[model samples]
Target: MTLNQMFDFTPVYIYIVAAVQLFIGFSLSFAIGQILPLRIREFMYYLFSFLFLFIPFLYEIATANVQSGMRSFLFYLALLITIFLFTKESFLKKLSLFFILIFFDGILEIVICSLYWKGICEKLFGLHYTPYINVPNQKVSTILIFFLPVALAEIAFNFLFPLLWKRYIRFIHLTTFVEMILLPVLCTNGFLIFLPELFGMTGWILLFFILFVLSLLFLHAVTQIPVI
Candidate 1:
């Protein structure tokens, strides 16, 4: 049997999705660590976020249906509430930051996937390797097109986020920051779930363009953050 037949790589997306959530979790911990005056050990922050994000997806993977829906949102919300309670920030600030973190995680992925998806898909197609069971509506080469670049973009963005944050992320009011980030999360997530067909090819190009504009505006809003 060929390597593709030897190893099943289809469920790999579960791991990839988990990995992205972990990255988001870590980024949230780091961001919260920076903003809050709590004296949390850096390791604990990562550990908490890891458990919070990992467990649900792990369960989904085991069950053979890894979906992002109302259930997923509720799981995340519960975890966010738990994490926020661990912080020293005021109640309202904690709530705002919770949404901000969620928004950041969601939008960051959208931006990366939007920008590099085609390049990643093309590169994979060039390899001409096919897994045994193919994904519906997609070729084997393209099955991971979204995940691979999102993974790369996640790493790059995570690195640049901290650096640029220090330089470019001036503290606007907490409420404003939350509001700005929230728009993209709602629109992107809602559109994706309800009208995913609108996100195909040309739609993705337009969606990405719109998201790019929003990201710029969000970054500009970041510059307005008041020193908290």
Candidate 2:
């Protein structure tokens, strides 16, 4: 499939919804961080992280729906809370990095999966493969598309996050910076969920423009963070 067709299949707003859920989880963690004593927060962080890791399993046990999208989303939300509690960085830096990491993961997943599908289609069926035609090993391709990008993104984050933290990120207060990231994600998510038909190409274009501006602002903000 062409890139445009691939883009058409995966709406931009799905990522926005995921981002909103992630931010909500982060906000909840932040609120908990405020209310709890340090010792309690530390203890709960470990405890909750361990339990959150089993969210998908718990979901499967409760609903018997192994392929439910809600299960995956809940797992990711749990992961965000786990990271928020575990990271030693200032809250603002943690929020910034979490946003970037989520964005990076979504981009990686789409690009890798789309390319893999295209390559396999072309290899087995020549250049004229259509989505309607059943391809061999379809189940294997589906599994790879679902799991490989996530695994790769996790590995990349584990390897690179510490380096980025040490070399680049400085502890800073920037509530506006975090708000800028959160607002667009939340708004897009709401629009797509409630008023999807009205949110078309124009809305998508506007969202991309907003994201580009935010990215530039983030880069500038990074430069202004004072070194401790």
Candidate 3:
């Protein structure tokens, strides 16, 4: 195949998704500001947030590998590390929370994207084509297929997470919050990795929607947990 055939031009929707990622990145920083004890200037906080979000995309472009799994993982890691640099929190505490949140988010991203690609994008949108037409690995194809849907989820979570943080902000302890988030992450990852194919397309759709609802519920429930 020719070089043209080897490249998969991203769709317009995916470009929109990139813009959403920027917003989500900003939202993450904003959320951290609300929770972290640091007192950064508003303007600088927004600037660093945008930097954390946009740099990964630049890295992807520089490498010409949009389906990079490690890059996606590293993006969040780097974002948290940068945040760590600015915060006054104990380094171990900050770093531990960073890893926890990143792991939770990564697992959540994978599950949601898998369900969307296997169910909605394929069955509804008729996007039957491989994720990376020219790319060879099935894992890469899987990552690429789910990237946009995950972006959409990230955008929604960006807004919703902060809202939960605001409402339940006084109630939940930090340790409890992390534990609450971990439950769904573990369950969803297990289902997707081991028993994913058990769900037919319709089943996947239902599962995805159920998980979406549960995510909101989980956030609300965590915030309502009283600090003993």
Off by over 4 Å in 2: 1-50, 60-69, 121-146, 164-228
Model 1 misplaced stretches (Cα beyond 4 Å): 1-12, 119-145, 190-228
TM-score of 1: 0.60
Full-model lDDT for every candidate: 0.57, 0.48, 0.56
Cα displacement (angstroms), candidate 2, residue 10, comes to: 26
Q: Tens-digit lDDT track for model 3 on 1-228? A: 543345465433333334555565666666666555664676776677677778766655455444444345445655675577566677755644553544545666777867877788789866764645244333433444556557767656654554565576435465556546644653433433222344467656866776777677677766677644
> Taking the tens digit of each residue's C-alpha lDDT, what string does model 2 give over 47-104?
6755675664555445534334455556556766776656566676556655544444
- Among all windows of ten consecutive residues in candidate 3, which has the lowest summed lDDT? 188-197
| Better-scoring candidate (lDDT), 2 or 3 | 3
TM-score list, all predictions: 0.60, 0.44, 0.55
Positional deviation of 82 in candidate 1, in angstroms? 4.9
Candidate number that wins on TM-score, 1 or 3: 1
